[model samples]
Target: MRAPGAALEVALQAHPDDGFLLLRTARGAGGRPQDVEITWANPTALRLLGARVAPPCRASDAMPPDVVSQWVARYEKAVTGPGRSWTNGVHGSSGHDATGSLYSAAFFPADDGVVVHLRAASHVMSALARDALHDPLTDLPNRRLLDEYLGMALTRIARHRHPVGVLFCDVDNLKWVNDRLGHAAGDRLLRHVARRIRAAVRDEDFVARFGGDEFVVVVQDLPDLEAVSALAERVLAAVRGDLTLDAVSLHAGVSIGVAVATEAMTAAQVLSRADSALYRAKRQGRGRTRAFDTALSREVDRRLTLEADLRQAIERQELELAYQPLFDLSSDTLAGVEALIRWRHPSGTVRLPGSFLDVAEETGLIVPICEWVLATACTAARGWVPAAGPRFKLHLNHAACHLGDGQMTAHVQAALDSSGLDPGRVVVEVTESQVLTDFDEAHTALSALRALGVGVALDDFGTGYSSLTRLQRLPVDVVKLDGSFIEHLEHRDRDRDVVRSVIDLSHSLHAAVVGEGIETDDQQRVLRDLGCDLGQGFHLARPVGAAQVSAML
Candidate 1:
């Protein structure tokens, strides 16, 4: 057998990357082993002992007292007797101990002493393991690790009968930032967002980036929905705070969807529930948190059904338009008809535009649906023979999808050519919100339509950011006052004053004003007395089919 000192010397010389140490048993006065003395150590071992200590040192002299105690406890089992072969896994503190970097040590009995091998635990891990478990950008946990953590949380809940909550956070308008500033700004925004979220959650909570401006948080052992909601609100507030990246003043908000697992649920189901709630928050306008419930689930299921049906709705002839007569208050007669789209469901029920228009817009179905409405309305207008007042006009609403596609003029011209309706008598109505969202695009589209001799009317005019400055910037031929303005017009002076000012502004712009949702003669009289030009509502005439419209004419 090699001598004790020779064994340690050969091991230290051969294994330069790992720390090597030879520890001899030191006994007390009663011949009982009291502790182990570090008889010899390699340069790597001295380095692992930290720069504060020298080579000839004991375990207690080299490491923290607690770590030395742990090391002694672990080595006691290995060094039972002389020539007894034993081994143990051990840990010790290293010089670069910011996060408490640890060395994994294995001790083996050799030639009346213990031979110890030490390596940094971090280096012992494979690169694939690190990459798979951590996000490369933010160094937070990735989706794979998230799945594991969420699954374990769910399992714990099942065993302990507690609730597991999750918050799915989505960055709103990230695409806008990416398009406006640059992708580099967008990436920095995401990293800052990740840090903010990490700072918001508890030390025990886990956060993961689930790709593309989406993050998932695993909240374990939440007691009830209130606790879950409170945590979600905290997370939202943390994410919604001001952020500036790379000398660019950027504003971004997060919409969070929350779900809790109190019963038997798979991780995917919980995530899907949260995702569905996120859809609701985004649909209701962003920067809010929504919790998953039975009603939302039902609504989601119904929307899914409607979306599938709407894809084939046009081919099935399930779509048609109704005309509501717009009256010219000055002429005291029917002025124009607004085409409204309705869906004839297979269940023998009629669905209003509100029931499915949002779904249509989201699914890109609004494009073809608007085209169809334009063609049908032009055809009906061409067939109409106005015997009394001026030539009848056909008013149709333009979807933002149409404006954003930059094809509004081509679609309008095609409809006119196919139906032979005069472009001078056709009015394409767009809402103020659409203009606000994509100002340049909507402006270009509307300007091009006006150049084609088609009049452009601003629908729902007073609801959004419709300042006089913005209104004057738009090249509109008419402005339809939103229904809210006329809802309380009989009582509220504020409503009346707003309508009066808008009327004056529109007239000054040489554009006519139309009051929508005029449900009473009193409201109509008030609007006309306020100098409103034209009006359309249930009081004027409810939306009617082609035959009813022809009869009314």
Candidate 2:
């Protein structure tokens, strides 16, 4: 019979994928095997290890630290134990090649010490490459692959002089689906939409997931602008109609923004224009397509400039809080003051929250802005004298995004602690539509706020799709009736009935009902008769500066 070392040497010499190494145990103090020395290596082992010199070198010098440590442990076990063979997988630079390839290493006891057989894992490398370029959920190309594909399409456009069309498709009502049906259903909906979108576009056209409910489709060699528009329409039609997820039927729709590449445009520029158009389509009502044009380009530029300015507006002292007083309807006494933010633009005009809040929320600038608001509002409330009314609270409206992360409670606590204001006198208000996006998360956040002795109010109630049962489940001390419900209270029976039911329900739940937007005396009278605890609007008080509010108090 052939010797084990000779057999291994003969068997692996011509092997293409396997590498073999013969190692002798290197002992230290007390005869413990501390390391190993490479006595012999096959041609494949030398190539894989990127070893420049021949064997008779220390394993530490021949392999990476991690690989050497692993091999040393296996060598000790093979030499000292029952001579049982061992096999395991490892990942590191093969030879000096730093490619970090995966390998399966098998160990066997040898006459001198141990022998190791290594096999390259080419299939695992291919899978890793595939995962890097594609979305695991939808199995579609991701943004990175999209960029490369777009680059190729742009190159084709440069060579052939044909326009490349890019469509930015955003799923509509996805937040609603996620909120009501759960995220698992939302993911199923996304996968379903992905299938429809892929089926809609031509095989040559590239479709990629661009993160969150957004997808990008690139059509190469488009003849004209009309072709882009037609493709957008096809995508819209493809993703529309009813789809069932988790046994619940949902109407699916997407808003598309179309941009045709110009000769000088880069990938980012094209995508930006398409995104701007997509926002326009969403604004114009969803399930529609809008093409990028000069008007949209100008709008995008203006928005970018505004966003940049808003970033500095806080440091420049351009942002200020306007306090609007909420009244106790029964005695016509001031119950509280709601702090509303206003931007005194450098252009000599006062901008309402409506003018720039959307931008702030989208840019994630709302967090800092809100922090500033909390500090300022708390400090202002702390300055109020006995005349401000001992029981009057300070209400501050918070964006849902600011409150969702479980950090708003800490922020509010910090503001209150710094300003030495009573948490009992503070009420944090969140809009109904915003709160419904993630009700459980909102509830947890609100519960934490309430635990701190501050009150929580569901603002703009009846504006959202939440039912009375949902309202009953929320942790709130107050419910602010949406202005729409109170707008036609004097003339519309439906509005009056809805307002009455909301107040009755709120009161039964031990929550105060505040009627908002009381423009006329009749609205206030009806609200008071319906047992609304408080009211706020232009008729009672317009939002004013801190000085004005202090003076009034």
Task: Report the number of backbone clashes for model 2.
Answer: 3
- Model 1 alpha-carbon miss at residue 393, Å: 2.9
Most lDDT-accurate candidate: 2
| Candidate 2 structure quality by residue, lDDT tens digits, 1-553 | 1234654655465454578778786545246655688888776677667665777777777777877777777777666665264332222222223356556666776555577776667644766889999999999999999998888778766677889889999999898789778999899999999999999999988999999999999987778778999999999999999988778888999999999985856788889888988999997878999999878888788889989999989779899999999899999987889999999999999999998988898888888998899999999999984567877999998876767787799899999999999999999999987787678878888999999999999999988888999999999999999898888899999888888898889889999999989999999999988888999999999988888877877
Q: Estimate the Cα RMSD of every predicted model relative to the unseen true structure.
A: 13.9, 7.4
All candidates: TM-score: 0.71, 0.73
Provide the overall lDDT of each model, using Cα atoms, as 2-decimal numbers. 0.82, 0.84
lDDT of 2: 0.84
On TM-score, the candidate that comes out on top is 2
Residue range 407-521, candidate 1, lDDT tens digits = 7888899999999888998999999999988687778889999999999999998778668888999999999999999998988999999899999989999999999999998
